[model samples]
Target: MSEHPIELSTRMIDTGVVDTPSNRVTEELSELADGVAIVESFSHVVAVRTDDGLVAFDSSGSGSGAQVVEALRRWDDDPVHSIVYTHGHLDHVGGSAAFAADAEDRGRPRPRVVGHERILDRFERYELTSGYNRMINMRQFGGAARSARRLDERPFLPDATLRPDVTYEDHRTETIGGVEIEMHHCEGETDDHTWSYLPGFDMISAGDQFIWNFPNCGNPQKVQRYPVEWAESLRAMAAKGAELFVPAHGLPIAGRDRIRTCLETVATTLEDLVADVIEAMNAGAVLDEILHTVTVPDEALDLPYLQPLYDEPEFVVRNIWRLYGGWYDGNPARLKPAPDATVGAEVVDLAGGIDRVIERARATSTAGDHRLACHLIEFAVAADPSSPAVHEARRAIYAARRGGETSLMAKGIFKSAEADSTTVIDGEAPPLRMIRDLGD
Candidate 1:
């Protein structure tokens, strides 16, 4: 029996400035074991304890982490000895310092951080897209996407990296604090998600692999993930005879049969989506065409656990394309794209006058159609960026659609665009265009 008990915390909050409704939505669903208490750090700190020691997880450190430690204090004063990170996402890995600090004060063994080997790479990718990420985060919080100011540095780095700390080429087993645990490496959600099983408790802690919402197979802003691999992982977990399932986000699921059904349903949905996407690609369809073509069956969509609260099927299709096709979408016009202004100006001339486009934009915005309105306004803005009418129209259209958005990822981008259009109206310089200029 292992001496150190791994931890899980239920406490989490939006550490960033603009908190989305989804943040709260996700929080209300987090759960831990019965005898083993759950703690809330910021809004998402999660931890668990056993006979040996404590094991905690999540990244809402500082305020969030402090809250988690306080919650644990409500139960036992035992020091935490093990920390398991589900993946490298900021909210999951950011709160380590506070927990480690408290454990230090108690003279408990310093918590050993564990995570997938790819966490380091995840951090590097975040740094590379810092400007874009910062903007998205601001939008996610309902703040301005870009600041004329500078970076805030909230997206932190992980310490005590795990080279599969316990190491699993595919699946591996370990016993922490006398709690029999199983860890499986999955390529879903994030590239190296760890789905853990505690046999003694008949509980399964599926990191992001099995969230209550529809699988986040199609995150709009992040890199590619393997849908096939994700499906396989879900099926593998469903086969486990766990009576209790604690998802990283959302409610706890009980009963072996129900859990198996939920797991199987998500797995099948992803598999179908991937198969359909690949079939479309094989038919030589472009990315946009493929995205518009693939659809999730209403049966799967109807599942309460399969809500599209985070990501949609279209985004997953695009991610799959990236996995197979790299950056270029095989369109020769985009092989070496011209500047937006250059293309927009030519397109505007072809469509007649810029005023004609703005008139169409006004019409679309008036009809309560932001998607078309934004498309028209983007051309006008890119070409005749100084037009106040165009700016106001863009801002208004985005605002109308913003509240209707469901996922934080989607709301963030749309809100940011709205803010940028307003900034242009207020005589503030917009963000550097190079941020979204793919080749740039």
Candidate 2:
């Protein structure tokens, strides 16, 4: 048995994060709506009553905004005075149009929309990377990528831009209807994240910075993230001494000590992880070599709050490398490389035909050597996508790989292989696993 108990647990589990699947709206919404009324499209919504009207934050990405609006209707018809966005992620701002439309109908003041100045730039970049974004969304949502719809328009745009409206360079204190909101800007999971502190009520909304899982500073398909800066931000928030810390993605945390310890541990782990990677790089270790060598401290990884469910420390190391150093990993072969298929075909030919590669892949896969099996099968498939043996080998490798995975990135890669394979993996399995026993 592993020494660490938290390795088998997650922030959602340790903190007792529960979103009971109910036809009923969230109790937070149910209670808050009793007077000023606010609905959240998805399960994650925060509503606070101010002197002027109600201010609601974030409509969930899954089109649950209508449910939130309806829940608010049950409470009161008082217009939504404001809607503040923590960041520009699709999940955070995808359902704004519905609430905006509702607020328009009552001759009630249109909710003044607010977000960081960089959000507009964030949206435009999404427009540029629409195709890539579509592919990633398909993987995240477990569906075929949205090919027919315009990715740019598919994500709803915010109104009355906060591009500069009520913008703060570092921090700002704003009171809406007598409710004091302390705004602090920090770059973490996203470049444009803003955390709101309701000092009067002793509540804070942490946006993506303190997402229940590991800090996702190293997403495989997204822009560069600042892991070191992210750690600093987490420390800053922890120092605020908030009584209630409500995160954008998971359950709300009550009590100062719990919130502070959780956030500080995340910060310390990341800053140390970055230092580890930097030390390895300074010693002239290459990227792949460093990935195999560097590791976050065991104590940090064992923390319930820092599970690598979505992203891993190695990914963060890679991001840091990209930020400070160029893409060159000091490898001459990759400096001016041939296309992937060309290289794969050469590898397959050297292995004495595709059949030999397939056979070897099957043996490796059966032996639970998925990393090796994946490389062999991927080369075989890439060299000849139409070959039945290649397809079979790829499917077998993918299925074997899925069984040993923990992080979301690994699962997504295996799932993509399954999707492209001629034969699917036999049965669906959960991604949750014990992390400590599987060690460096």
Candidate 3:
């Protein structure tokens, strides 16, 4: 949108813009240093020129892969020496096939795709949970929120997705064209995450571990994240004294001091959250109490790099508890809880009817208690899921909920809920489950 992607990114970074064009893949290449550059994509491709060829970190994504390769070609035709996966996330590594295809077209051996040893397991798990991934991803980004559209039955790890050819245990160091690159495994967003550093350039190619947003160790839809170790990894990268800091998803920072502040602030935020959550747990507070009572420093959140735009702090607290404790939230009623519909039907009977509950939910929502309003609406929907009136209220309430949220995670989920209700109101045969209920 600006003259250049980096300019756009830097402007957003300086102005504290969370909805950034940097996250968009333009398939344009910009050089940061001699023989080093970045290809702007959904997940960027950071390349280092080597006598052997080009060493690239991350390959955009499946849909954007071909464009990313084309963008890099416009800058340099050097065959890719290697492609490093910052992590196994689809956006980061999904484009590996394009890189391999390019190598074949140029009559060269495929670039070695390198990643942590756990990546294979991650891929395997994707295969096992493809439906779930499709559901969550659609909710996270597609605004599909339990939509009636057919979920993709194919494996989430597509045939185009490439497994890492070069795997390392914890740390791996090697020289590509005489420049040393260090890859270190850090469990944060993903257990198999790796961040690379080039001492020669004093630049760190931080994977999602240091995304511009608050540490994504709190992605509610995903697996257990390592916040404690995530902070440790950020500190480790900061201690490297890197001059140029390139993250997988945001603006590349140039100054050493700026880079250190970002790394330390994010690390400190996580460390503080961990300490507070653990203290609350030790003091015999339930998970709900800790969730409501926990507070993140406003100062930390005010920092550009530490914005809770994607994953916020409270989710991080829940993740911390999950890591240290079990799924049991210390609520005996929920330990072996009755089904929502059963409980909601009972509540509806005591409260007069579903209509009365919906009216209260509307008032709660009007009073700016969207959280409580959603709860009441959910109970109403559970009690009489087929009622158009209940769904209409759900649609409006969730739209309000989505509007008030800052983080993408919260917004996406709320938007999806809104979409779900909208679907029923529109009467497009609802998600198959709803149709089945109608038949019953």
Candidate 4:
């Protein structure tokens, strides 16, 4: 057998350097154990053979659904009898239509789609906010992630979304084709998340819980995430004594010990953040004070799986505050804040003129003060949006900020800003208005 993902992760831990993200979605299928195979895609599709037919966990996304089915056919021709969703995320459930089509073509009935009861509510919410979700996807993903087919774009949660046919509240166990599947409801990335385990196979199909990056509990563009409950779920999975751990997005790990260690490490890091943030919150600390003071230990972050590739810990701090503290942000003036443009104009006026603000912005940027440079550039732009010189400086400053970020979330937003300034300069568009930028 090829080197298991666990072996690679183990070596990475030993070297103290993460070579790549654990959430790569290359479309390929590999079996780490007998009768079980994992298809790596935008989200992984884990196929388990059973006497009744094939039981697949997560069918991949709409873009890779056919590829997932093709890979499974090359390995095992069993008709998919049941497809389990790890959550309501499009990447996790988008491929169910493809699976259903495959079954129909083979003279078999459609596979039963299964997930947590809250998934139904999630689908309803997506339908209600499809327009906003579509816009968010375009900004956040740059390319059309909301569209299933790259060229033929669809709505964010298109009418074609395959809603779950079976739903559970907390925990459920059932025998399918003589093999038992245990599904536990847990909230982490989504309120409707579910992690499944196969007792006989000694494997856990952990949805997005243990993705190789820091738990994406703080995605700025996304809704509220549960860091407190996220840590608890990881601990529960670790106690299962599973020999194989398959995640929906990243590399699947092998060996009971390796699985436990990786899960425990991820759990502890999150638990630590929650504890530190809550303690600060309890002391009546303002969000700004807690944000600047609280930090994840360098050692914990240096671990292979704990790398901040997708979402960093700083955003997580903000999310924790949002969950318990409400949106006031502790700034008295911001509570009933003036327009962003109005505030920027005031800052520029304080600096004497738009020209002075632009000069300082460029100088501060060159002096390795990119953060302050950005604020100054925004002030200059607000004061004189038609200035080509200021726009060029804004583009360069945001590009520099993008270069210094580690997480994809930060990089994308900064890149979006850089691109926006470029558009204003190149197209001679009207003064750039700051919209929520998404990444390419």
| Leading candidate by lDDT | 3
Runs of candidate 4 exceeding 4 Å displacement: 1-6, 14-17, 143-153, 428-440
In the range 1-440, model 4's lDDT, one tens digit per residue, is 44455566667765776666555566767876899998878788999999999999988888889999999999999889899999998887888888888888999999988899998988888878777676555555652222221234456775565788899999999999999999999999989999998998999999899887888999888899999899999999999989888888777877788888888989989988989999998999999999899999998888777888879999999999999888888899989977766777788888898878888988888888888899889877766665678888888887787788888888877776666566667754532254321111
Q: Give the per-residue lDDT digits (tens) of candidate 1, residues 307-392.
A: 67677776787888888767778688998988887776777898898888888887887787877787887887777665667778
Q: How do the residues 102-194 of candidate 3 rate in per-residue lDDT, one tens digit apiece?
A: 989989999888899999999999988888898888888867847533555666777878788889999999998988999999988989988
Tens digits of lDDT, candidate 2, 1-440? 12111221234445544333111234234342223222322346677777788777765553566666766666656677777778888767766666766777776655777777777788888767766677776664452312222234543334422332444557767788888888888898888888988877787877788766678888777888988888888888888898777676644666778778788878888887788888888888888887788887765665556667778777888888887777897788998987656777899899999889999999998988888988888777667655666776786678778777767776776776666563222322211111111222
Off by over 4 Å in 3: 1-24, 428-440
> lDDT of all predictions, in order shown?
0.67, 0.68, 0.85, 0.82
Steric clash pairs (candidate 3)? none
Q: Candidate 1, which ten residues in sequence have the lowest lDDT sum?
A: 2-11
Of 1 and 2, the candidate ranking higher by lDDT: 2
Worst 10 residues of 3 by lDDT: 431-440
> Which pairs in model 2 have colliding backbones?
39-68, 40-68, 41-64, 41-65, 51-177
| Ranked candidates (lDDT, high to low) | 3, 4, 2, 1
